[model samples]
Target: MSETTAEKIPVTVLTGYLGAGKTTLLNRILSENHGKKYAVIVNEFGEIGIDNDLIIGADEEVFEMNNGCICCTVRGDLVRILDGLMKRKGKFDAIIVETTGLADPAPVAQTFFVDEDVQNNARLDAVVTVADAKWLSDRLKDAPEAKNQIAFADVIVLNKTDLVTPPELAEVEGRIRAINPYAKLHRTQRCQVALSDVLERGAFDLDRILELEPEFLAADEHDHDHEHCHDENCTHEHHHHDHDHHHDHDHGHGHGMKHYHDEDMQSLSLHSDKPLDPNKFMPWLQQLVATEGQKILRSKGILAFSGDDDRYVFQGVHMMLEGDHQRAWKEGEPRQSRLVFIGRELPEQTIRDGFERCIAA
Candidate 1:
């Protein structure tokens, strides 16, 4: 459905590992002149709803889930809270669920799917992940939560890119790519990406699934040489921004990076040039997730099934998978099936063999 649909309020789940700059990006989103009202539901450690007080409005609500929203227990609270929020829906334009840096985003996302009330009123707009460029590589080596955050992201804000060297930056980006090649990757400093790139993206909207390949968006980088603001202390009485400090070196850094792979967390991408048999593909996909969901972190696809004219779209978090016939194939659209999975200890050969079996003869 289109984002303009009045039926469902869009929700953006913001997640990241500790010290990944999620709050910074969130503040940028709220601080900017977007002319949109957002209802923010935040759960931070230490019960400090400091950010909530900073936001202004009758529509803006903040209920702290003191314990991290890591599992199904918190999911219940989320569902109830969302159900209550729906009653006052018309007051706010969109909702932002900001999970703690350490919290898993799966349960938060699942709320929209599992709850009938939430599903009827709110849509999962996107999972926007913020990553720390200087330390993500190290975190990936030791932290599974960090890997999951990166894997589940629809839009990834690669924040603090200026903190790392060119090689380190590329290494981090390559590491992120290894896990999720379909996310819209944007590089930023102090989480300064354009609000448009993050909020109300319609990232999860079926009609917006134009491409599966990751987009390299040079966000927060529009060449405007006018009205330079260099002093860090300047409070922007005149909203001037040069942002040119990193422009020269940042322009030429994407191609030379070495591909760094996480041994446990890897993405498996499968594509078929021919149409797939829906009857076979659907059952196999369900069975695959049923047995291996624990190992899988995220899954998404756009499919071309035999005897079907519309492009089929699907998205999954662990075992919970959802798909629908989006739109009819355009005149020159290529009929192809593309699937991606980010998970731990993936049964790659088994998956490949299984998918091959689903191709139409």
Candidate 2:
């Protein structure tokens, strides 16, 4: 089954806040001589490639661009548009969904994993986020969707380098790094990044994540900046510690940069040197997400089971989880398990206690 992946088309999700150069980067992709065919799905008409064009389907808002790429407006639902595109699949090499600037990427990404028909025909390649370096800092403070976009990104294009000073640029990058250190970061002007960097990144593919390792931020001792959101998902009756206070635990960053701690949204990383009992671990994880998935925006694990030679990996979006045995552990490699959860007001103690119980006795 090594060649099983080739049968599906790769879908790259483009996301960011308003005026983040998503359209510019997208136009670059459409105009570049990559010698590949693309079927683009935009949220509304006249947002992308609206120049002297041909109307292939008026009611459907599907048309052909001057560059020979097929473009369509997302009139009603995304699944319907994808279903229509699937019929003409062979004509294109890949699918790129440029979500509206105000859109949340979770539902868009969830389509590839939750729908069996979409899953069979397409595989998620990556979530590419275009950020306006000049204003990302401000958005990070005001917008929940902005933070989620940064946390969920696999590739981040920090564009408009020409707009700010060196100090301003570093602060913006630091803010982005605080949320997600794993995404590939590229600083560009006018969204002039190499095409190879964004397309076909395979960020969600199991093979691409073969060695799943993450860098984490720890609780900082000095910062005082904090903000909280009383999300309904965070207000659960957990039989544990005080849930009334803000969960603002800031991690120290470089150069005396103020560590901006998001009270409502944050990431937690758990690790175990000891092998986990699969019977116990699997059920605990499923139950954890089943009850808390609405709060959990994303979850992933690279596990080393107690009695198995092969490693297991899983990726989740809300309530959906997909996992499989990846490959045998190398002779000299350390056998350990690492799990990460990024979400809003997660039940840390419940998750920690449950994870601790999964360790093999």
**Clashing residue pairs, backbone N/CA/C < 3 A, model 2:** 220-250
Q: Worst ten-residue run, lDDT, model 1?
A: 234-243
Candidate 1 residue-wise lDDT, 1-361, digit = tens:
2334567888998898988888777676666677877777766533333444323222222243343332222266667667778677687788887777777777777666666677777899999999999999899888878888998898898889889987788778767766765577788899888888888777767667664333311122222111123333221111111122332344434445454556777777677888999999999999998788868777878899999999999877777788899899899977878787778889988998999999999
**Candidates' TM-scores?**
0.80, 0.79
lDDT of each: 0.71, 0.71
Taking the tens digit of each residue's C-alpha lDDT, what string does model 2 give over 1-361? 1334446888888899999999899888888889987777766567567442221222222222233212211223556666777787678888888877777777777767656677778888889999999999999999888888988887889999899987688678767755664567788999999988899887777764653242221221213212122333321222111112333332222334444456667666677779999999999998887788778877878899999999898888777688999899999997878787877788888898899999999
Residue runs of model 1 more than 4 Å from their true location after superposition: 1-5, 45-74, 211-255
For candidate 1, the per-residue lDDT at 300 reads 78
Candidate 2: Cα lDDT at 90: 77
